[model samples]
Target chain A: MKLLESVGRIVAISRKEIRQLRRDRLTFGMVVAIPIVQLVLFGYAINEDVRHLRAAAVDYANTQNSRLLLADAHASQVIDLVRKASSAEELEEWLRRGEIRVGIVIPADYERRLEDRKRHGRSARPLAQILVDASDPATYGSVAGLLNLPPPERPGIQPPRWRYGSAISGVSNPPPTFEARPFYNPERRSAVHIVPGLVGVILTMTMVLFTSVAIVRERERGSLELLITTPMKPVELMVGKILPYVLIGLIQVGLVLGVGALIFRVPLRATPQDTIVAALVFITASLTLGLLISTIAKTQFQAFQLTFFSFLPQMLLSGFMFPFDAMPRPAQWIAELMPLTHFLRVIRGILLRGARVVEMRHEIWPLAVFALVMLTLAAGRFRKRLD
Target chain B: MSESAEQVIRSQGLTRRFGSLVAVDHVDLEVPKASVYGFLGPNGSGKTTTIRMLCGLLEPSEGKAQVLGLEVPKEAEGLRRRVGYMTQRFSLFEDLSVFENLDFLGEIHSLKASHRRSRIDTLLERYRLADRRKQRAGTLSGGQKQRLALAAAVLHEPELLFLDEPTSAVDPENRRDFWESIFQLADEGTTVLCSTHYMEEAERCHLLAILDHGKLVANGTPQQLMDDVDATVVEIQTEDPRRVREQLAGMTGLLSLAQLGNRLRLLLHREVENPVWQVEEELDIDAGATVQVVRPNLEDVFVVVTRDEVS
Candidate 1:
C-alpha cells in the first residue's frame, strides 16, 4: 500500500510535466525540429574525401611527356589544373595566394630522361618535383598520393622495373602492393561515420540543455517552493520530471536514425535490441548530467551558460570531429571523462561496426557509471528547502 | 499537555538563521485550530521565513517546532500532505490551464480519481474559475490567478493552510474576495496561517503576530493588540498637514506621525501629559486646526510595536 502511494505521486508529477510540455508549443517544436535540421545540415556539409582540389603546374618541359604527366594528374580526379605557370615563382605565388593546393614542376630534361632510360635500361631517375601546401593535412594527403603516381603510358618507354627484383624471382620478390580496403565504409563517406555519432551528439545537446533548466526555471519562478510544500520526495520528483523527456529523447533518436537511414543510407549494423540498450544508456547519462547542472545552478540563465560551456568540451574532445588517437595524452585523458566520448564509441560501434553489447562493455560500462554517479549527485543536491 | 490538543501548530523558540543573519528569531506560538492567524510585518522582517519553518519547508537553526502534532524536519514529509501552502508569488505552473493545475495538485495529494474530479469541480465553482478553466494560468488576470492559486492550494482539503502574502499581487477588491474565500475555508474547520503587510488584512484576522527584524514584537487578537499598545493616538486636521508633520517630527514622547490627506495621525508615548494638548501645542494649532484623541487601530499598534526597531 505504501509502495502504491509512492507510485501514485510519481505518476502525478509526470502527468503534470506532460501537460506543461504539451502547452509549451515553442519548446515542443524545438524538441522535434532541431534534430531533423541538424542531421540534414551536418550530414551533407562534412565530407572527408577531398576532391577537385585546384593545382598549378610549372611545366618547363613543355614537351609531350610533361603534358602527358600533367594530363594524368588532372585525369585522376584528385587535382584540377586551374592555371599553367611559366616559372616556379608563379607556382609558388599561386600556392601562397591559396588559389591552388598542389604545384607540379617538371624539369626541362624530362623527355631526355625517358630516352636515356630506354637506351641504358635504368639510369638516374628523372627529377619531377611536386610542391604541395600541406597546411590542411586531410586534403594534402589525397593530393600528394595522386601526384606521386607514375606518368602516363608511352610506346618506347617501359615502366620502371621493381627495385628489389621481379615477382617471379624466388630469392627476393618486389615489395607487395600496399592495398588497403576499409572494412565497413569502403567509400569512406564522412556521413556514414558522422551520422551515427550525430545521434549521440544531438541527444546529448538537446537532452542536457533542456533538462538543465527544468528545475532551475521552477525555482526562479517560485513554483519549486510550492512543490516542496507537498509530500513529494526528491527522488520521485526527479524521476517524474525526467520521464517525459526520456520518451522525447527516444523519439529524437528515432527521427535522426530514420533520416540517417533514408537520406544518407547509413547502415544499422547492430540488432534492434543492442541499439535500444545503447540509446537508453546514453540518454540516461545525458539527462542525469542535465539534472546535476540544474541542481547546482541558481537560475535558468546560469543553467543555460553551464550547459553551453559543458557542451563545447563534449563536441571537441569526444572524437566526434577529430580523431581521438591524434589528440595529446592529457586531452585524451580528459576525453575519457566525457559521457559523449564513451557514447560515441558505443553508437558508432553499434551502427557502423556491428558491435554487440557484449563486445562494447568497455564503452557501455563508463556510460552506466556516469549515469549512476551523476543521478546520485543530482538527487543529493536537490534539497526540499528554498535555501 | 491537554492544551496542546487545542493548538494545531505549537512552537517553542523556533528560529532560523542564514549565516550571520537571523531570519527568524526564537518565536513561541500556539495557533489554535479553526482560527485565522495573521503574520504582519514589513518586507525582510522574517514573516515568510517563519511561515516556511512552520510549513516544514525550512529547518530551524536554533529551536524546534511541532506542526500538526509531529516533530518538524524529521516528520516534515508526513506533515506535508496534511498542510497546503500558497506562496507570495503565483507559483502555479503558468503553462498549465486552471483545471490542469488543480488536477495535478489533487493527484499529488493522492486523492482518488472520483474524489479528485468532484473536489476540483467544486473548487472551480467556489473560486468562480469555472469559466476560465481552460485558460492558461499565466495569461489570467491577477485576480483570476489568485483564485486559481487558492483553489489549487485547497484541492486536497488540508487540515491547515499556510498563505505567504497570497494576496500581495491582487487589487483591493480582489484581496477582499480572496479573504472571503479564506474565511469560508476557516469556517469549515480548517486552520489558516497567512502573512501580510496590509494593516486592514491583519485587523480582520482572529489573531495577529507582529515581527520586526526577525523577532516577534507583539501577538494578540486585533482588539487585544490595539488595547495593549502603550501609546495614545491623536488626529489633527489642518490646512497644511505636512507643516504640522514637520512641527511634530521631533516632539518629545512622539512615537510616529502619519499624514493622511489633510489629517495628521500621531501616536504618542503613554507617558505624555494630555496627548491631544501636546500635539496641538507642538503643531501650533489655532482655530483652523482641530486636535482630538482617537481610538487605537491596528496601524497604531503596528507603529507602537515596530517603532523602536526602525529607529
Candidate 2:
C-alpha cells in the first residue's frame, strides 16, 4: 500500500511536469533543437583532423635544400605556406600578431648541418625548427603530425631533424607527433571521435541546465509554495520531476546517435543493451547534477550562469576536446572528479571501441556513484522551507 | 502553545528573523476551528511570515505552533494534507488549463480519478469557472485567476485553508465574489486564516488580529476591537481643511488624522475628554470649522495600533 501511494504521487507529479513542458513551446523546442545544433557545431567546430594551418617560413639558409623543405611543407597540405619572413624576429612578430600558426625557420646552414650530421653521425642541434603556436594544444598536435607525410624527396641525404618548437602559448617545449596512429577511427574522421563525445557533452549541457533550473523556476513563479505545502515528499518531488526529463534524455540519445550514424556515418559498435544501460546511467548522472544546481541556485538566471560555467571545465578537460592522457596530472585529477569525464570514457568506449557496459566498469561505477551523491546533495539542499 | 479541540491553529511566541532583522516578533495566536480569522497589517508587518510559519513553508526562529493538531515544522508533513495554502500570488501553473491544474493537484493528493473528477466539477461550478475549465490559467483575467487559485487550494477538501493577501490584486467586485466563496467554505466547517491590508476585507472576518512590526497589538471581533479600542474618534469640518490639519498635526495624544474631503477626521486617546473642543481650540476658528466626536471603524483601529511609531 505504501509503495502504491508513492507511485501514485510520483506519477502525478510526472504527469504535471509533462503537461507544463508541453505548454512551454520554447522549452519543448529546445529538447530537440539542442542536440542537432550541438552536433553540427561540435562536429565541424572541434574537428581535430586539422588541415591548412596558416604558415610563414624564415629561410636563413636561402639554399636549394631550404627551398625544397619549404615546398615539401606546403605540398604536404598540412600547413599553408602563406608568407616568407626576412628574419626569424619577423617570423616571431608574425606569430605574435596571430597571423600565422606554423613558422618554419630553416637554420642559416641547413645543408652544412645535414652534411655535419652524416659526417659525424651526430649533429650539434636539430637541422631546423618548426615554431608552432601551442595556445590551443588540441590543434597544434596536428601540426606536429605533419611528419606523417614523406620527407621532401632528399636523395641519399638523411632525414632533416625539424624539431617541433612552441611560442607564446606558455609551453616552452611540447611533445612531438602524439597519437598519430589513428586506431579505432582508421579513416581519421574527426566525426568518429566527436559524435560519441557529443552524446555526453550535449546531454550534460541540456540535462543539467534544464533540471538545475527546475526548482528555482518554480520558486520564482511562486508555485513552489503550493508544491511543498502538498503532501509531496522531497524524494517524491525529485523523482517525479526528473522522469519526463529522463524520457526526453532518452529521445535525445536516440536522435543524436541515429543522426550521427545516418548523417555522419559514424558507426555505433556497441550492442543495444550496452548502449541503453550506459546512456541511462549517464543521463541520470547528468540530471542529478542539474538537480543539484537547481537546489543551489536561487534564481533561474543564476542557474543558467552556473550551468554554463560548469560546462567549461568539462568541455576543456574531459577528453572531449583535448586528449585525456595529454593533460597534466593535476588537470587529469580534477577531470577524474567530474561525472562527464567518466561518461566520455564510457560513451566513447561503447560507441567507438565496441565495449560492453559491464566491461566498462572502470568508467560506469564512478557515474553511478556520481548519480547517488548528487541525488543526495540535491535532496538535502531542497529543504521544504521557503527561506 | 495550549491545545484545545476548538482551536485549529495555535501558536505561542512565534518569531522569525532574517539575518539580523526580526521579521516576526513574539506573536501569540489562538485560531478557533471553522472561524474566519484575519490578519490586518500593512506591508512588512509580519503577516505573511506568520502565515508561512503556520503553513510549514517557513520555520520560526523562536516559539511553537500546533496547526491541525500537529506540531508545525516538526510534524508539518502530517499538517500538509490536512491544510491548504493559497499564496498571495496566483500560484497555480499558468500554462496549465484550469482542469489540468486541479487534476494535477488531485493526483498529488492521491485522490482516485473518479473522485477527483467530481471534486473538480463541483469546484468549477462553485467558483464559476465551469466555462473556463479548458482555458490556460495564464490567459485568465485577474478575477478568473483568483477563483482558479482558490479552487485549486480547496480541491483536495482540506480541513483548514490559509490565504496570504489573496485579494490584494483584485478589484472590489471580484474581491467580494472571492469572499463569498470563503464564507461558503467556512460554512462547510473548514477553518480559514487570511491576511490582508484592506480595511473592508479585515472588517468582514469573524475575528481579526492586527500585527504591527511583527507584534500582535489587538485580537477580537471587528465590533469588539472597535468598542475596546484605546483611542476615540473626532471629526472636524472647516473651510480650510489643510490649515486645520496643520494646526492639529502635532497635538498631544493625537493618534491619527485624515482629511475626508472638507472634513478632518482624527483619533485621539480616550482620555482626551471633549476632543472636539481641543481640535477647535487648535484651529482657532469661530464659525469656519465644525467638530464632533465620532464612532471608530476598522481603519481607526489600524491607525491607532500602527501609527504609534510616529508619536
| Most accurate candidate by lDDT | 2
Candidate 1 Cα errors over 4 Å, as ranges: A45-176, B246-250, B283-287
Model 2 lDDT tens row, B135-232 = 99999999999999998889889999999999988999999999998999999999999999999999999999999888898899999999887898
- TM-scores (chain A) of the candidates: 0.69, 0.67
Tell me which residue pairs clash in candidate 1.
none
Q: Tens-digit lDDT track for model 1 on B45-162?
A: 9999998888878889978888899998778888888898888989998888898888888877888999999998999998999999899899999999989988888888899999
Candidate 2: segments with Cα more than 4 A from true spot: A45-182, B1-3, B250-252, B285-287, B309-311
Docking verdict class for candidate 1 = medium
State the C-alpha lDDT per candidate.
0.82, 0.83
B-chain TM-score, every candidate?
Answer: 0.96, 0.96
DockQ of every candidate: 0.64, 0.62
lDDT of 2 at A209: 89
Instruction: Please tell me what DockQ candidate 2 reaches.
Output: 0.62
Candidate 2 positional error at B296, Å: 0.8
